[model samples]
Structure formats: C-alpha cells, structure tokens
Target chain A: MSGAHLLVRVGETTAALPAAAVRRVVRSLRLHPLPGAGEGLLGLAEFAGEPLAVLDLARLMGAAGVAGASPAVTVVTWIGPAGDRELVGLAVDEALEVAELDLGAAAAGAGEVLVAERPVRLVDLERLGEEA
Target chain B: MSPELVVVRRAGALWGVPAAAVAAIERGPEGVTVRLAGGRELGAEAVVGLSGEVSVRGLAPPVRRRLPPAVAGLALWNSEPVAVLGVAAAPAGGRR
Candidate 1:
C-alpha cells in the first residue's frame, strides 16, 4: 500500500476504497433481495431508518467469494462524484485495515491497481450509480 | 391499501402472495410450493411458512426490475424484507 486507503476484503480481491470516500464500517449488512438488480447489486438496507442500497463488492469485482470467508463487513461509502453522490453500502467478506498504497511501484491496470505488495482490483466508486 | 397476503418463503427470502390467488400450499421434494389457482407456481428452496397478512408497498423502479416478475412488491415482516409476488410475470426476463 502506498497512499492512504481503506483495505477491505471483497471476495478474493483486497479492494481499496479511498479512505475519504468511506463513511463507516459496520458488522454485516442484513440485505433484502432486489430481484432485478444487476449481479453486482445485492438489495436494500436501512441506515438510521432510511433506505440504503447495498452492493456486493465481490460481485462487482467479478470474483464473487473467498474460501474460509469470515463474517461480513459493510462499508458505507459515498459513490459517484460530488453533487451527484449517494450513500451506498459495499458489503465485503471483511475489513482488513486502513493502509497506504503505493500505486507508483507496481504495474496496475485492467480494473486493478497495485497496492502494497500486490495488485488489487480498482473499484471506481464514482461510476457505480449507473450500473446499479 | 393492499389486501390480505399469504406469506411465502422461497430461495431463502420471504415472499408475500395474495391470499385470494393461492390454491394450496404444499411441501414436496422441491421444498415449499405455493400453487396458484391460475396454474402458476411459486416454489421455494426452504419450507413454506404461511403466516398472517403483511402490508406491501410498490417497489421503486430500480428495485422492481432486478427481481423476477413473481415478486409484486415489498413488505416488512418481523423487521425482515419480504418480496411480495404477483401471479402474472413481470414484463421482461424474470429468472432467479
């Protein structure tokens, strides 16, 4: 990891959603089905009595799951650009830790970015709304 | 306001089918199946639990489209989300 980032385990990928974009991390998101929602989208959740859309980070990354999965962690974050931002929960296998990721050191591309010692998928939180 | 609904659980989620439309609730190898008078079938992987009526609200377009046509709307039962189903298929692709 090089720059300030919040590392979360989304299936087999260790995704880094910018720390600034992360609102909060909660233990497990209880989800309801959004039957026609895209594969990456899970369903809905309530945050402070308000409806919240929960998206599966693993499904979005296209990996799906990791063996020996731990308890689920819901990362509430803002997706999309400012003025068009929305609060959405990104559910992952677990929240690893907040670390500094050095993208300049590794070869990263194709929807992935280099972090610390490995290349992890790069999630564009900004463009998420259109897909869900 | 919506009318009476027969609670049906399928594929690990709770579903609400209109009371008037249900012919019989049976248990077989496919798990709990809610057979409709119109010859439509709503099957579940888990056992069907028909409980009291639940209130339902129309789904937001984004939420409605992702689910199968069988899911009519949404309801909250026991603080859990329930997908209220309609007997007729939704307009498009509705595979689970």
Candidate 2:
C-alpha cells in the first residue's frame, strides 16, 4: 500500500493517522456494541465471518460527539501482543483527503489547529498497534 | 520477546497495555474501550467524555509490582499506569 497520511477530523480539529495503518474508509457499517465493552470501542462487527473491533477515534482524542446519521471513517489497524491485526473503526466527523508529506516536515504536538491547517504529525502504523 | 505495547497519551496522562493485551481499540459513542487479552475490557471514560486524559481500572497488577532492571526500559510504556494482568506463579523449576 502507498505510504500517505490521512487527514481526518475528530470534531473541528484535524488529526492524522497513517494511510497505511488504515485498511479502508468505510461508511454505513452496522456498529454493534459489546456488553461491558470500554467507552472508546464502538462495538464488534463480523466482516467475512471474522469479528472485528470498532474503535471510536473521536472518543479517544476527547473530540466532540458525532451527530446522528453522520458519515464516519473506520481505520483498521492491527492490535494484540502477537501483532494480530484487528480492525478498529475510528469515528470521525468528516473524512479528509489523503496527502503525502515528508516525515521530518510533518509537525508533532502542534495542538489541534496546526493539525487542521498543515500536516501536524507523522502517522506510525506500528505505533498505532502498540498504542491502541 | 513479548508483544509490543502501545502507548497512548490522553488528558495529559499516559497509559499503556501490551499490544497483545489489546484485542481491539476503538472509538465508541462513549469513549475509547481497550479490550484486553481475555474477554475482559476497560473503558477510558475521559476519552469517552472527551475530557482529555483520565485514568480508569485496567488489567490485574503484576506480582512483581516493581519491574526488574531488564524490564525497566519498558517503563516508558507507563505514560500512565496501564492496566496490567498479573503474572501467574511459576512451577518448581520456573515452568509456567
């Protein structure tokens, strides 16, 4: 897969996750909530007979709540200690275009404004699993 | 080697879980829910409340609360006290 950064909005602010880390931006997928599941987890979905965990990115970043029937983009990254790839869906207010930027030039820790205006950070696919 | 751990900084505090312990990390109507190695799960309410970084109960604590020198370097993963599962007692010869 091409190495590019995906610019997305948690609410008003823009944040980026690596395009490579993202399996695909899906819409209108039925998100089922798991009993006693954590807050950030939207729920589990059976994609091709395999159950995948859906993650709420906005909830993770402390962003605004998504409105009803609004479109969301799911970024499926691998999780688990053994590097078992798990699909985690991030709920975003809007799905921005993908862009390619130099790693060094990509800003880090610039706060929400810088992220929306310019490429604020480099998305590390490996780290997503470790951190998620 | 153990599976890599993922570190997330929420609400100014850091927390980590064995990347393996995390079955999946997802955004929900509420907040970030981290599924553990087993079916057990924990919710980062702050992440759900959008309140920034906040702490919550996680996995069981390890028997050796203090990590050995060999694992000290891994302490960086403790951006916040991550929910850790306890280590089971080894058999006579250290067999699991």
Candidate 3:
C-alpha cells in the first residue's frame, strides 16, 4: 500500500492498472465494428446513445484471443493531447478494484513494471489509441 | 435493464465460425446445463458472472451469455459465488 493503487483481481492474483487511466468498469457489451479499424479497436459501443470506441485490453495484454471479448471489463479512459482529453474504452479480462502504492515501492524498467509486487507489462495509456 | 451480452465474429474462418468468436474463457471441467435469455439452455463446462453479466466462456462453440434487465443475482458454479457484472450487446462488430 504505497502511493500507487493495488488492483484487486476478479478472481485471484493481484494485477494493477493506473487509477488515473481508468474511468469506470462495466460489464461486457457488443462492440460496434468500425470499417477498416486497426488491431486494438475491439469495436464501437454506444453508451447512453453516444458511440464510444472500445479497445480490447485482453488482446493488448496478450491475456486472451480475438474472440475473448466475452466476460471482459470495459475501462473508459481519457487520452489527453495538449490538454485535450479523448475518451476510449478498454476491455480487460476482468475489472479489479484499485489500491494505492508508493512510487518508490518497487523497481521501474522500460516497458516493464513490478506492480503491487507482481511483475506485469507496463501499458502506455497515451499510446494505446495509436494505430498498431 | 440487465445489459445485453456482447457477441462477435472472430477472425480466421473455420467451419462457419471465426477465430475471434472463439474466446479463451475457462469452461468448468464439469459442465452444467444453463438456461439463458433467448429461452435456450446450453450445456457449458464453466461460466463466469462478473459485475452483472454471466458469460459461459471456454466452450468450443463459444456461448455468449446474455442477462436480461429483469435478472439480477449471483451466478453459482458448483455452488460457489462468482463475479457478477452488467451485460450489454456489442455494436455490429464488437470492441473496435
């Protein structure tokens, strides 16, 4: 329990996602597909009549496959560019609760992170929207 | 209303089933027959309910569990409590 928040898994094993990057977690939804979309875009989903871009976090994390959209968590994040925030949706294996951790509590490596004492790939939320 | 279950057509064509539709969700070793929304009961090995949606992943055919708004409760597998989340229908495609 440091400055960084700890992630409570839906099942077992503690995984961490940046609190600042997450807006809210919701149940899985049918993602509307965008013609000629890239790899990360799970598809398009409408929330309250407003269309939202959904990104498959499980695929991005290498946890699941393309059809693994079922039983996933939708994390709405705001990507800011020059103070402009663009909203995006991320689908994960599950929505784990958030916990805070100290910045100096663990080691930090390039493209690598030891979150909550668990080794995981550090995701760059900012670059998530870019075409891969 | 309970959210709609998101369904998708996976990539890589295989016997009328796309590879994308084949999720890696775990089906229970001991499968159970479940009656879901569409008045259809399917035999599934394992099912996971989170937030409010119940998903029967890991099946070869890939069962997309849809929970209607009227249904609200914990999903029991082998008499154990599982995560429950809201369910919703994905757009025409899914995720992107």
Question: Among these predicted structures, which one has the highest TM-score?
Answer: 1
Q: Among these predicted structures, which one has the highest lDDT?
A: 1
Better of 1 and 2 by TM-score: 1
On TM-score, the stronger of 2 and 3 is 2
Highest DockQ, which number? Answer: 1
Interface RMSD of each: 4.9, 15.1, 15.6
DockQ of 3: 0.02
Put down candidate 3 lDDT per residue, A1-132, tens digits, no spaces: 344432533233234556776666677765545334445655555453433556655554554443454436676665534344455666665555565544443344544445546755445555443433
For residues A57-122, write the lDDT of model 2, one tens digit per residue: 655555565665333666555433234333445667777878764554443343222433553434
Please provide, for model 3 over B55-86, each residue's C-alpha lDDT reduced to its tens digit, 9 standing for 90 to 100: 32110000111121212222222233221222
Candidate 1's residue-wise lDDT over B1-96, tens digit each?
365667655545666777787788777866666678767776665534454665565543333435566666666655666666676762221123
Summing lDDT over every window of 10 consecutive residues in candidate 2 chain A, give the lowest-scoring window.
A107-116
Task: Report lDDT per candidate.
Answer: 0.63, 0.45, 0.40
Error (Å) of candidate 2 at residue B9 is 36
**TM (chain A) per model:** 0.78, 0.70, 0.69
Say which prediction, candidate 1 or candidate 2, comes out ahead on lDDT: 1
Question: RMSD of model 3, in Å?
Answer: 15.2
